[model samples]
Target: MFTQAKLIITAVVLAALIGLGTWWHLSRVHAAEKAVHAHYAVVLSEIREKTAAAVTAFRATETAWRSAIDKEAANGQARIDLARHDAAGARTERDRLLADVARYRTAARTAQHSSAPTAGPTTGDALDLFADLFSRADARAGELAEFADAAHAAGLTCERSFDALSRTKPATVQAPQSNQ
Candidate 1:
């Protein structure tokens, strides 16, 4: 009979097994996460480098444009001043747009930190420790999985054997044979 005590114990064991399974897989999951973060970091760095280069090129172009506009032999000082003021406005707009793009890119990442290390602890000590722990736990889970399978098969076999042995068979009768 599956008494309450037996039921409770089974529940506990099943829960423990699930917990172990989760821990075992956590190693792989964590590793995958670290890989993704590393990839993103590399990408972000590349983006920053490229952005800086682009900004440098933009400044150079603007400088050249300003030089050309200033050196223009226009007879009207008023027109020259107006053109310079417009160029300044364009510069302001460009700078504002660049700042907005950077801000939005940062915002896209959301909370910025969790389940990952921030610019700290370049040492591999803690990493090695967790790697070892996860490896051992996962290996243990593999062993337990084999045992769990065998136990399941054994339990089913035991139940079927008992059912066959304890079940009552119906009695059968044959008609009396006539003399031949």
Candidate 2:
């Protein structure tokens, strides 16, 4: 049996050890949490940057499509207008894809900050969607090139028709010749 003083000393020592252990555990947890938060911030920042880049590209495509459409419309070439309409539609699809990318980036940022699972599609899904969109844009560009060529040819035809009409001579009526 330990003496009363010894028992008291033992109890105090145990309490002190427990307190130190708790402090150490809490500090370690805090450090780990900070590290996790830093990593999440970095990941979210990367997603944001990629999303912004995609959005910028989409906007540029939209602008180019609009310009091409307006120019063709002003030229009064029906075939070109039709092709430009197709380009505009393609741009619209691109905008939608870019908008989805923006939503994904927003969700990722929110998930990172709140440490919660995002709803609906996963990040991978969004990435795949963007890849598909990019492929479609490439295809659309090729089609646009062909359409432009055809439209140019059609414009030349239109111009030739106008020139031919302009060069036409008016018919003149002559009085009947008098009998000798």
Candidate 3:
């Protein structure tokens, strides 16, 4: 009977010791898990904040770029308008000069064809045709020159706008020279 009682008491003490050890181990594991979770949460929050900041900065840069392009377009339009107005005014003077050219050609032709003894020629065969051709060619050249000037001004304005928007220098392009 005494030996059985001693064995029972020893068994109870061992069971209590095992329970306490299990409790201690579980508490340590729980603490480690909580520490890891907190560290991950902090890292995740930092990543999210940085991403938001980066997006905002990118949006600002895009807006500024758009504004720059808009400004360049407006300036180009103004330049084109001014060029057109000036060209139109030049056309008024050109019209008057063309009228004077026609009047002088008619008078010269009449004087050459006259057989009058007072003023001028008795014959005008090929010279009259040549004079008419020269007058026509000179008037056509003047018209072409004015058109080229206006077109060149407008083209330059467009090129400047493109260069400004693209943030580059003015690039020159030469036409291929024709052998003819």
Clashes of each: 0, 0, 0
Q: How do the residues 89-155 of candidate 1 rate in per-residue lDDT, one tens digit apiece?
A: 6556655755664465445434333346568763354544655565566556555654555455556
In the range 24-142, model 3's lDDT, one tens digit per residue, is 99999999999988877877776777667766766666666667667766766676677667666766766776677667667776875574555543335455566667667766866
Better of 2 and 3 by TM-score: 3
lDDT of 2 by residue, 16-113 (tens): 99999999999999999999898778777767776777677667656655555555455656665666776778767767866776787677656766
Q: Which candidate number has the best TM-score? A: 3
- The CA lDDT of each predicted structure is 0.58, 0.68, 0.68
- The parts of candidate 3 lying over 4 Å away from their true place are 1-7, 113-180
> Which candidate model has the greater lDDT, 1 or 2?
2
In terms of lDDT, model 3 sits at 0.68
Tell me which residue pairs clash in candidate 3.
none
lDDT of 2 at 108: 67
RMSD of each: 49.8, 44.4, 13.0
| Residue-level lDDT for 10 in candidate 3 | 87
The residue-level lDDT of candidate 1 at 34 comes to 100
TM-score rank order: 3, 2, 1
